[model samples]
Target chain A: MVENRPVLNVITHLVLILGIVIVALPIWITFVASTHDAVRMTQAPIPMLPGGHFWENFTQTLLGSGLSGTETAPVWRMLLNSLAMALMIALGKIAISLISAFAIVYFKFPFRMMFFWLIFVTLMLPVEVRILPTFEVVADLGMLNSYWGLSIPLIASATATFMFRQVFLTIPDEMLESARIDGAGPLRFFWDILIPLSRTNIAALFVILFIYGWNQYLWPLLITTDTDMTTIVMSIKQMLEAAEQSPQWNIIMMTALLAMLPPVFVVVAMQKLFVQGLTETDK
Target chain B: MLKRVHFPRSVLPYLLVAPQILITLVFFIWPASQAVYQSFLIEDAFGLSTEFVWFENFELLVDDELYLQSFGRTIFFSAAVALLSMSAALVLAGFADRVVRGATTYRTLMIWPYAVAPVLAGALWVFMFNPTLGIFPFLLDMVGIDWNHYLNGTHAMMLVIFAAAWKQIAYNFLFYLAAMQSIPRSLIEAAAIDGAGPVRRFIDHIFPLISPTTFFLLVINAVYAFFDTFGIIHAVTQGGPANSTTILVYKVFNDGFVGLDLGGSAAQSVILMVLVIAMTVVQFRYIERKVEY
Candidate 1:
């Protein structure tokens, strides 16, 4: 850029364009596959171009049973399940993390560091590592096949708590003192002063956590044995497996598109917040 | 780390922190301890008996060929996915950072895949490469290459790897691009003025400046490939065609749920837990060191 080499500039653009193509190709193919009928999808050399049956596939996928022979909830139902789960997880995590972070940063409490370490241990024990026992615990609590089952166990986030803690630490001590001088209680101070100050962090973390909750697969797949409780993300596997027998590529790909739409929309529409939350939380 | 003007010790803070501690205790710590305890016990196939056989399960895992092969395969898969996705992202980020215009446009296009569920990503790629009706195999037929991932181990591994890496590229790209953008422009301009070409500047100045990010991303990507790609592998191959694509996580799930090998699976889970703990420690240490830089 400094030397203004036209060839280098063109090369950069070309390479970027190629990168975009590679990144977008599978999705493009998915879109193309979704636009066709079931019959056309079974043939060799599936359509690269979009077919005219997009609405037909969309309607059938969203309204009708997702895959025949498989006892899946309707696509719309699964979408609703995904939405509910995502919102619950995002809100639940933000709520618990906010209060805990408030406790850690603003209030002196017994066993605070122990509690922090407890939450820290959760970071190392992803559900994947504690699969069978965690399933047993959830089952023992009679929470399986429910929203609580879907979201509660996954809601304790060390990173979000830590992020909020970091945000609160950077706040001036004067704010707390001023709140205390104004006779604000600890809860009142947190609800008004601290919450308002960390609004952006909360919103950004929501964006990231929503995508995370929406995309959850193994946990939901394990807990929700009830077909009606199936999340859209977890249903994709059923469709994929059912496709082996029935070869409903059109319907399967349409379900795939619908499952992906909300989170992808969140990422693209909330790009700035998404980027902020990602770099901040993961780092 | 508490604020200087913190509230006095009170039950209010206990109330505030109780929910997280409760959930962590019930869900994480309890289950983790259960796994550790179960790892020391061998359950009968009919669940009629469980014997406390400390170190026997671990010993079995050590001597088990399938477990060892799975261990090796997991390392290979993690390395392959991390290397492929990170290098691709680094190259794309390098080029994306060079763009004078529409960089945001390029980035927006690139990063939305990060929001796609790993299973959905796998489904998309598996569909694209679905042996019979898939367009890729159709094209490959012209070049006389057979491409059935369902039956072929190597093809299945390649399929899962591609799917895993494809889903990860968006994340790695986002991080790499952010890292590159954070490098001081003055350093780059100075390198350019000193007669270094763009590549030379990148190699000499830009890349070195971003090595911290590279290290950070390496840990992240490794963790991702280890734990997060379960959905991808599950949806795409189910560790199929004779357990070809079965990484450690998949094997744990399969062994516990499907194979009903509770003790073996619990042992694997404990090992994975230790692995995650080690990785988390490494990450925190690296981050601490990174702050000094």
Candidate 2:
């Protein structure tokens, strides 16, 4: 049997190897391209290998934007802002999803179904399509050009609420009944019982929210006009427009690949957890 | 089971729901209404100065040949991208599901493309398709076909479809693989024991079980393709090569931002909302019935 299977296994491995090459090549090329100077990248059959100008390019990119270079992109500052903004988004989503899910599932009340349906209905409204009018709300609330403007609206996603609720619905009633018999009050039982059991679900939500927040483009790009408080995506977008002609493809590619790292790492490191978390959705 | 509920718990539900309500209203409901309101007005050909003319924008949008053509093109593009991406993902994910060696690595590599920013992905393909240095042009030259996206409408449209497909294939793959992994292995084995060949077992057993997930993803992906792809289009071609790539969302953005005609953009947006809402209603009325859970 082992001898007979060698050819099939070889084909499988070959296909997988090809898959990895295709998946990693664009990004791998981008990473190397970032290290080289811009002038070198324009050459034909561009270098297939990494160059030695990484530090030089990195330093120049950081300083390249600012008043000195036609409205310089504060890449580092935006990195910090992006981290802060994405963190807020992640934290806000988790807290809200957990709380809302608990309320709708564990504690029943009037209009419960109404509210649940309402939250779920929110999923259908594509934010990109509705963004123009929402700008007016941002203006009306005086939330424009601030972290509040960037973070507030995103926290309202019905998707996470829907996700957490689905996770909650799967647990057997026996656990809750047993906890109640043990004299564990609501908060104590939820903290000790529910939260511990749902760690995987929470982690999945974290990965999902973090990536969504990190990759946000149009809204942040449109809303935040201030250079000091722009998200990484906004900064990247500005860099794209500013450097459209003869773009330092290396630096831009580097930033793009770097931006993608955290999410990719989240998926890789938590592969087992994320898979379980995703698979658990139907429950 | 009907014991008296505590007061704190009674108010707790509202507290939990408050943030969602506030954010949704401000970001979604309010702005959506505003978009509808602005759709009724008119702006001059110059576009900067706005004047209030009731239903003129909407009326004009109804009679506009350019809008009609672009709208039809948008529908065709959305349907094509969604179906192609979904089918591709299902096949790849199904293949990955059975492959034991390096399965995790393969999954990770495949899904990483989803994380690439839209602009970056768009730009990456531009490099690939550019005639002076693009790999595709190199490909076309060997085949004795002149393929230039920068100047050719057909080539540019193909490039847009491929780029858009690349962005979504990763996401759909993740969902399908996740769905397949959830199916109990015992059933698959049992089906195999009954003499279901690989292809037969897949069609009869696996596809049905995965249909719910497939259906759910269909609705979600359909919405994404219909409304969220303007960025990819905007970044790649700006609806170039004789406006063949211009879709509805791109037109909305172009009119609102570039042309400085807010009224016209809003009118187009209103029509956009109607189409989306109608599609959503149909999805729920007919397609959603197939969702198992």
For model 1, what is the error of residue B204's alpha carbon versus the real structure, in angstroms, after optimal superposition? 1.4
| Off by more than 4 A, model 2 | A1-6, A62-70, A108-110, A171-193, A242-244, A276-283, B1-9, B43-56, B142-147, B179-214, B278-293
lDDT of 2 by residue, B1-293 (tens): 22123223467678767777667776777777888878777666775766778888877887999988898888888777788888878877877777776787788778777666666666667766667655567667889988788689888888777777777888788888877877888888888778776668789988999887777777767776777676667767888878899988888878776776778888887787777777677666754375442
Highest DockQ against the true fold, candidate:
1
Best by lDDT: 1
C-alpha lDDT of residue B59 in model 2: 79
Candidate 2 colliding pairs: A65-A72, A65-A73, A66-A72, A133-B31, A134-B31
Q: Best candidate per TM-score, number?
A: 1
Query: Taking the candidates in order, what DockQ does each have?
Result: 0.90, 0.38
Question: What is the DockQ (computed on Cα atoms) for candidate 2?
Answer: 0.38
Which 10-residue window of candidate 1 chain B scores lowest in summed lDDT?
Answer: B284-293
